[model samples]
Target chain A: MVSIQNLHKKFGKHTVLDGLELNIDDHGIIAVLGPNGSGKTTLIKSILGMVVPEKGSIHINGKPLKNNWEYRKEIDYLPQIANFPGNLTVIELLKMIKDLRGEAKREQELINFFGVNKFIDKKLTNLSGGMKQKVNLVLTFMFDSPLVILDEPTTGLDPVSILKLKELLHKEKASGKTILVTSHIMEFVESVSDRIVFLWEGKIYFNGSVEELKEKTNQRDFEHAIATLLTGEHV
Target chain B: MFKILKYSFFDLTRSSWSYIYFLFYLLLGIVLLFLNNDLSNAVITLMNVIIILVPLIGTIFGVMYFYNSREFTELLLAQPVKRTSIFLGQYLGVAVSLSLSLVLGLGIPFIAYGLFQSPAIWDFTMLLITGVFLTLIFSALAFNIALSSENKIKGFGYAILMWLLLAVVYDGVFLLSLVYFQEYPLDKFSLIATMLNPIDLSRILILLKLDISALLGYTGAVFKQFFGTSFGSVISLSVLVLWTILPLLNIARIVKKKDF
Candidate 1:
C-alpha cells in the first residue's frame, strides 16, 4: 500500500504537483492517466524517492518514504525510457542488477517469456528500440516484488509483445501484486487497468472504476470519456 | 557500494577510451624519459605534464562518465541502496580507475628506467602523489558540476570552463596581479593565491621538492621565499586533501536534495 499527502512541486514558474493526495490499498492494476506534464512520472518518481517533493510526505506501508530505501526492496521500477549503459551486455546488466538486489532465479523465465535470449549477449546500444523495451520489461518482471511501478511500459512494444505484457500483468495481479502503470494507449488502458486515477493540473481529477468514469462523464465509449475528462468537462 | 563500484570500474575498463588514455600517458612517460637525459629534469617535466594534464583528464572523464552512466545511475537510484553510496561508489570508481591508469602508465616507464634506483625517487613519488591528488580533486569537482547542471551540454561547458580557469587562465591572472602590484611585497599574496588553486599548489609542491628554484616562476619563487620546504609541502598536501573532500561532500549534499 502507498499513501501520499499534500504534495507540492514546482519547476521554475511551472507548478507540476500542487496539494495533491493519493492512496492505494488494493492489489490490482492501477493506471495513472494524465495529459502531458500532468505529474504522472513526477508522482512515481517521488514515491521512489528519485524526486524530492518541495512539501509532502509519502508513506509506504506505514513507514515514511523520506531518507528511507529499505522499502524499495519490495518495489520494482520500470523507468519510462529504455536507456541503458551501452557498453554493457544484456547479460552483464541482468547479472549486475541481480547481484545488487539479492538473487532472483526467475530471470531466465522472464528472459524466455520476453524472448530476449536471442540478443542477450549483445551490447544494449546494439538492440533495437523494441528490443530494448523488452529487456527493460524482463528486468522489471524478473523480480517477484510485491509492488511494481511501470512508467509507459507500452512504449515501442509491438502488438504481440503487448499481449505478452498484458498476460504478464495478469499473472502478477492474480498473485496479489499491486502494479502501477501509465500509458497513452486507450485500448491498453481499457483492457488492463482495474482502476483509473485521472490527473489534471497536478491534482487527481477522477479516481474510480471504469464504469464509474463512464457514468461520471456521461460518455458511452471509454476513449471518449477520457477525452471528456481531459477537456475539463467532467468533474 | 562495492557492487556499484565494481560495475562502474568494469564498465570503464571495457571502454576503448580508457586504453587510449593509458597508452597516451605511457607514451608520454617513455618519450620524456628517453629524450630528457637528466633524470631530475625528466621528473620536473613529468610534474608539468601531470599538473596541467591530470586535472584536465580528470575533469573531462568525470563529467563524461556521469552523463554517460546516467541510465545506469537511474537504475541504481531506484534500487534499495543508499543515495550517498551510489554517488560515492561511482566517484571512487572513476577516480580509482583513472589513478590506476596514471600510476601504471607512468610507473611502467619510470620503473623500467630504473627510477627507483636513482636519487630522484622521492621527486618522482611526489609527482605521482600530486598527480593522484589533482585527479581526485578535479574529478570530484566535475561530478559536482554534472550533478548540479541537468543539461548535459551545460554540464560539459561548465566543467571544461572550470578546467580552463584553474589550469590555464588562473596563471595569467596571477601573473598580471603580481606585475600590477610590483611595488608591494607579494610574498603572502602569491603564497595564498598558489595555495588556493590545486593546480598551483601541486606545481609548487613538486618544484619545491625537486629544489629547482630557477624553474619556480614568480609565484613559485614567492612561495619558496615565504615557507620552508617541509612546511610548504605539508600545507599544500593538506589543502589538496581538503580540495578533494569538499567537492565530494558538496556532491552528497546536492544529491540529497536533487530530483532525478
Candidate 2:
C-alpha cells in the first residue's frame, strides 16, 4: 500500500501538484486520469522519487522513502517513454537490471510473463515504437517488485500486444501486486482498472471504483462517466 | 564507492573507442622514441611537452565521453544507486581508464628510451604518475561542468576555459609576473603560482627529473626547496588528488539533489 499526504509540487512559480492526498491499498489496479499538465506525470515521478515535492510526504508499505534509497528496491517504474543507450540490446539491458536488483525468482517470473523472448536480442533503438513500449513493459515487470508505477503503459502497442499486456497485468493483480497506472487511453483504463482516480487542476476530484464512478454519473460506460465528471464543475 | 567504480568500468569498456586516441598517443610516443637514436636534449624537451599533452587529451575526451552519456546517466540515477556512488564511479572510471591508456601510450616508450639513454627510471616513472594525477584533476573539473550543465555547448565551453586557464593562461600570467617582479624575490610567489595549476606542477616534476629544475629560473629553486624532498612530492601529489576529489564530492551533492 502507498499513502500520499497533502502533496504540493512546484516548478518555479507554477504549482503542478497542490494539497493532494490519495491512498492506494494492496493488490489493485488504480488508473489515474487527468488532462495534460494536470500533475499526472509529476505525481508518478514524485512517488518514484524522481522529483521532490515542495510539501508533504509519501510512504510506501509503511516506510517513508529516504535519501538513502533502500525503499526503491521495492518499486518498479515505466516512464511514458522509456529510453536507453542506443547500443543496448534488449538482453543486455535486462541483464543489467537483473544484476542491479540481485533477485532471481522475481526476475525469472517477470521476464517469462512479459514475453521478453521475442526481442531479447534486439537493440532498443532499432525496435519499433510498439516494440520499444513492450521492452519497457518487460523491464517494469522484470524485477517483480512489490509496487509498480507505470505512466501510459499501453501507449504505442498494437491490439494484440495490448491484449497480451492486459492478460499479464490481470495475472499480476490476482497474485497481489499493487499497480498504479496513468493513461489517456480511456478504454484500456475502463477495462483494466479496479479503481479510477480522477485528478483535475492539481487536485483529486474523485476517488472510487470504476463501477462507482459510472453509477455516480449515471452513465453506462466508465469513459463517458469520467468525461462527465471531468467536464462538470462541481466535485 | 567500489560498486559505483565497478559499474563505471564496465560502462567505459563497452564504449571502447574512448581509449583509441590514447593508443594513438602511445603510437606517437613510440615513433618519437624511434626518431631520436641518441635521445638528445631536444628529444627530452619534446617528451616533456608530450607528457603534459597526454593528460590534456585525457581531460578533453573524458569530459566529452561523460557528457555524451547523459541519457544513460539519467536512467541510472532513477535506480536505487546512491548519487555519491554514481559520481565517484564515473569519475574514477574516466580517471583510471585515461591513466592506463596514457601510461601504455607514453610509459612503455619512455622506459624503452630510458634503457637506451641511461636516464633514471624511477624519476621518469614518478613524472609519469604525476602527469596522470594532473590529468585526473582537470578531468574531474571538466566532468563536474558536464554534470551540472544542461546544455552541451555550455559544458564544453567551460571545459575549454578550464583547459586554457590551467594549461596555457596560467603559464602566461606567471611569465608576466616574472617580468614585473624582476627586482624582488618572487621565488616563493612563483612556486605557489605554478603549484596552483596541475599542468605546471606536472611540468615541474618532469623538469625536476631531467635535472633542469634550475632552468625554471628562480621558481625552480623555490620548488626545489619546497617539493624537492620525496615527502614534499607525495604531499603535492596528495594535494592534487584532493583537488580532484573535492569537486567530485560537490558534484555528487548537486547530482543527488538535482531533479533530473
- Tell me, by TM-score, which candidate is best: 1
Best by lDDT: 1
Itemize residue pairs with steric clashes in candidate 1. none
**Candidate 2 TM-score to native:** 0.89
Worst 10 residues of 2 chain A by lDDT: A104-113
Instruction: Identify the runs in model 1 with alpha carbons over 4 angstroms from their true place.
Output: none
**Candidate 1, residues A1-235: lDDT per residue as tens digits?**
8999999999889999999999999999999999999999999999999999999899999999998988999999999998888888999999998999988867999999999999999999899999999999988878799999999999999999999999999999999999999999999999999999999899998999899999999998999999999997865
Assess candidate 1 and give its TM-score to the true structure.
0.97
Residue A61 local lDDT, model 2: 83
TM-score of chain B of 1: 0.97
Candidate 2 residues B107-217, lDDT tens each? 777667764356555555665677677667777887778877878888888888877777778778889989987899887788678667777766666666666655655
Worst 10 residues of 1 chain B by lDDT: B219-228
> What are the candidates' individual DockQ scores?
0.83, 0.61
